[model samples]
Target: MINAQAANPFGEQSKLLETVAAWTLGLLWVLPLLYAIWTAFHPAEFATRFSLTAPLSLQNFVNAWHAAPFPRYFLNTFLLVTMILAAQIVLSTMAAYAFARYQFRGSNLMFMLVLMQLMVMPDILIVENYNTMNLLSLRDTILAIGLPYFASAFGIFLLRQTFKTVPRELDEAATVEGASALQTLWKVYVPLAKPIYLAFGLVSVSTHWNNFLWPLIVTNSVESRPLTVGLQVFSSTDQGVDWSIITAATLMTSAPLLLAFLLFQRQFVQSFMRAGIR
Candidate 1:
């Protein structure tokens, strides 16, 4: 193997270059996180300085928490994410089931329309969505922030693909046992699509949690503003920029998702892998 590698000098050089590029990119991504951690744990005076002897403290976190209405922000974010995820799952499941199992006059056309939606970026419809929200009087509400995302093309597509992989015999057997369409879905398709659901859930949660543009535009009040919007408002020019406190608040903003990912990372990875391989 060593001799073969030595003979393929160009291939070896390409791999070496790729490794270097990967490490460089990884460091670039991680440096800011390291800086945040350092600043969040040390005194403000040490924010720009690196010293092994610097005293570690949680005062920054305390100051950040006291500075903003973080509890309300957290509540808004939780409600927003949960409401969106639940609605997406229900709507996607029913739509995907119909597309995967039953056929109708406009089934193909409808499915094609859904596929077309996948091609259209949500940001492109920001104006239309905003206008609709205003018409519905849902502006500045958590429901308004989640309403546009309730029908997720990506979720429907993923679940449809997963549902299609189930055997026809099982579906027929469930029907023969006097199960209705919804019953069959709950007992058969849903159980089999657990991994897809999990993967989709993670994607939905992460996407909505970090979403900024739509929320910032839609929400104008503290009661409806999510963490991302709240954080942006807090870090704006109106508020004095203290790196230590800002970094602490940033960490606090991201902590729930980060901790959840750390705890379920293995499951998250496995679910995606299963969905992909299927």
Candidate 2:
């Protein structure tokens, strides 16, 4: 009886420690966001100082909205994300279906090379990609930004795992019904893997929306630059640093992803969990 009581106390202590760690990590992540909110709303005079008595104003947002072509930036980002996602879904789905269902010579080896991209992203190959883009004359184009990410190893891997989890009985049934291979995939496997698709899509949207380095490298003109790159123009040496305005711009750039996560917080969490399971 004494040993049982001691073990119970040890388990309780472990749970308490886990709870404390969770709270600590949560606060660490949230503090910067809270600080940014405070800074973004504060006036220029109060930007650097933390003041509870400071009046909140929409003036920073108003100034940021007027100072930059934020609408155009939003549209550009939205379009680029949509374009890349659409292409990725098609290409990755097909690649995943082939990788999951078909047995070809050296297929596993080829898939390994594709998965290697998850370890070394296109960012690490920027110089080579830039040269390729130059050869294709796609510099300063949205396509240049979207092209490299169209075939995503992560997406393929996620979908392949999900597809494999689906019962082979369905495939055999479709085959018995005289459905072709493409029909079996479209009608059978795709619907079953919907959760994985949603998870990958959410991840893709979030990543591409916040992507700066690749966009900055490929785009020079305002016509093709994403919000991250556009925000840089204001903070660059030529323009000089305006702390309040820069914070305001940073908030503007982050708003879409912030709003998206808020709106789909439950689904996003569940999707990530599902993706991890897959």
Candidate 3:
């Protein structure tokens, strides 16, 4: 009884420690976002000062919006993300279907090569991709910004795993109904993998939406510049840093992704769970 009582106290102490650690980590992660929210809403004088009577104003947002071509940047980013996602969905779907269903020679080798790409950082290929874009006379174009990312290795790998989980009986049943291979894939495998598709689409969209370095390197004109690049250039002007306006612009640029996550958070979690993601 004495030993049991001692062990119970130790277990409670461990649990208390874990709770404290979790709260600490959560606060650390949220600190920057909270600071941004504080800065974006208040006037410049109150940006670094936290006061109960601090006046909130939308003037910073207005100024930031008018100081640059944010609308054009938004349009370019939207087009680039949509185009890349569409191309990735089509290419990854077909490649994954072949890798999961076919028995061709060298198929395993090719899949292994695809997997190898996931380990390599994309920034390492920026110079080569830029040179190729120049050769094709596609420099400073939205297409150039998205061309290298159209065929995603991660998307192929993810879809292939989901496709492999599907049963062969379903494929054969579709074939018995006189459906073509494409029809079977669309009718059988695709429907069953909806959760995986949603999960992958979210990932692809978020990655490209926040992608800055390659877009900055590829696009030189306002017509093709994305929000990230535009924001960076706006914040670096000769007038020096204006924290209030910069934070407001940052919030505006990130609001779409934030709203998307907030609205679909439940679906996002459920999709990942159903897809068996760890």
Per-model TM values vs. the true structure? 0.92, 0.93, 0.94
lDDT of model 3, residue 215: 93
RMSD to the hidden true structure, all candidates: 2.3, 1.9, 2.2
The 0-to-1 C-alpha lDDT of every candidate, in the order given, reads 0.91, 0.86, 0.91
Name the regions of candidate 1 deviating beyond 4 angstroms.
Answer: 1-18, 237-239
Residue 9 deviation, candidate 1, in Å?
Answer: 6.6
> How close to the true structure is residue 257 of candidate 2, measured as C-alpha lDDT?
83
Stretches of candidate 3 off by over 4 Å are 1-11, 276-278
TM-score of 2: 0.93
Q: How close is candidate 3 to the true structure, as a TM-score?
A: 0.94
Per-residue lDDT tens digits for candidate 3, residues 93-159, read 9999999999999999999999999999999999999999999999999999999999999989888
Model 2 misplaced regions, further than 4 Å:
1-5, 237-240
lDDT of 1 by residue, 118-206 (tens): 89989999999999999999999999999999999899888998998999999899989999989999999999988788888888999
